[model samples]
Target: MSSAQQEEEVLGKAYDGRLMGRLLAYVRPYRWQVVVATLAAGLHSVTQVVGPYLNKVIIDRYLFPTHAPGSHSLIGNYLPADPWRGIASVALLYITMLVIGFALDFLQTWSMQWVGQHSMYDLRRDLFHHLQRLQISFFDRNPVGRMVTRVTNDVEMINDMISSALVAFFDDSFVLLLIIVVMFRFNWKLSLITLAVLPFMILATRAFRRAVRDSYRRIRVAVARINVFLQEHVTGMSVVQAFNREQRAYDEFDQINRVHLRAWTDAVFAYALYYPAIEFLSTLAIALILWFGGLRVLNHT
Candidate 1:
């Protein structure tokens, strides 16, 4: 990681840890809801595991049964007496899991949002009360727009990631771990091959995240500079026209506009490169899974 990314990581983790500790304290008043939400998340993860297992079972027993040919009633073979029945059962099982997963998803979402927003509302009230406690010099040093961005945009971002994305990420990671365990149980060789690509993908994600974050920060700065320029010009429009300084205003705008354009172009190029690289790597992993697993299945090895 770059030094900038390392610094960001450190700061982010520290802020997140502190905020979450405070947020968790809010659950004392809604302990039952929090418990229910936790259970809902667990159920969602279980559904994720069951969905893939159902697919495996359907493929093995219904779509391409190993013993179907010799399963004649007179042959006394123990293969499914009616493969269609098995398929129907699997279909029902899948649908049931889907419904359960969706319901749990909704419950988790609603509960987490309620808890998060409630805590944030209380926190904002406190912040406002504290803001009243600050001296006038604090207001003088911090621009109103900048302070608003911190209290509004920055706080909202924190709420979004912590309340929603954080829980969802935890649920996803649990599901992912369960999937890996089951996948390896199904076929360890294929699991190993598929997992070998994971590290590279994670590294690429980290690199792309840093690049995109820095690029977008630059874009925002450029946009802000342009806005400041426009604000000044518009505020002084009458004086400019009276002094016949239209040419000077145009020149200033052109310079700011060029900066904005460069910022946008650089951001676009960065994203273009980042997305295609990730897509290429993901595609390569899928192809390898198909090719290698197909061979292994055919060889019964």
Candidate 2:
């Protein structure tokens, strides 16, 4: 493998606190935006939880009207007894929740994106300034394309981590925590049954992460190779043409591109398998809930 490919293939620690601290330095300037975004994400998670609860309210009070003793005291007391009015009221509340969720989602996305772009701009400017001050030996050792990729593609990955991945982590954690609380509050037994599949889900997630990591490494190496090949050949295209090496160059490029294509194919395949596995696990959890909850309902226990 070429030096660029080798560099790309070199694995780093999964989580580097020092590196994260460095990245956080960029975010420190816009800490207030991050705070707003995090709050919005948390509220958005609440909106998600509320939707399902509203569905339950619609079923129990308005549509089905169980009228079970002590059950009609909570949400029912606030709602109109007339079915049509109650349904309309709940529908209005749901729409309002949807609107609030939309606004929160937009605010969170915009704020994070704004922070990411500004942070990356500062990062790239620093990188450019550093590059300008580098010694001549540094330029001789590193391929121009590799250096360009560091400034462009690698920095974009950091931006994605900031804007998308970190945000997702926070948002999903909030959703998960809220869902767990709601689930246990509603029925502890049913919640336990639903969560019985947690171990399997963890295993599947680990396997999926491993597969994706390998595929990503391959993709990075392939991309680095392509960049290096293109930089060298394109810059020396006149000499290649003079030497009648067009066919050879084309074949080499074709091979490099095929590696890139195969890497992407592997990544896609991993994702395809992962989503279905997660779906299966989710279905299993739901099935377990239905089976156990159905028994409870039937037994009036």
Q: Give the candidate number with the greatest TM-score.
A: 2
Judge candidate 1 at residue 256 and give its lDDT: 69
Q: What would the per-residue lDDT of candidate 2 be over residues 80-181, giving only the tens digit for each residue?
A: 989899889999999999999999999999999999999999999999999999999989988888888889888998999899997899889999999999
Ten contiguous residues minimizing lDDT sum, candidate 1: 70-79
TM-score of each: 0.74, 0.95
**Global CA lDDT computed for model 1:** 0.71
Candidate 1's TM-score: 0.74
Off by over 4 Å in 2: 1-4, 67-70
| Cα deviation of 250, candidate 1, in Å | 8.1
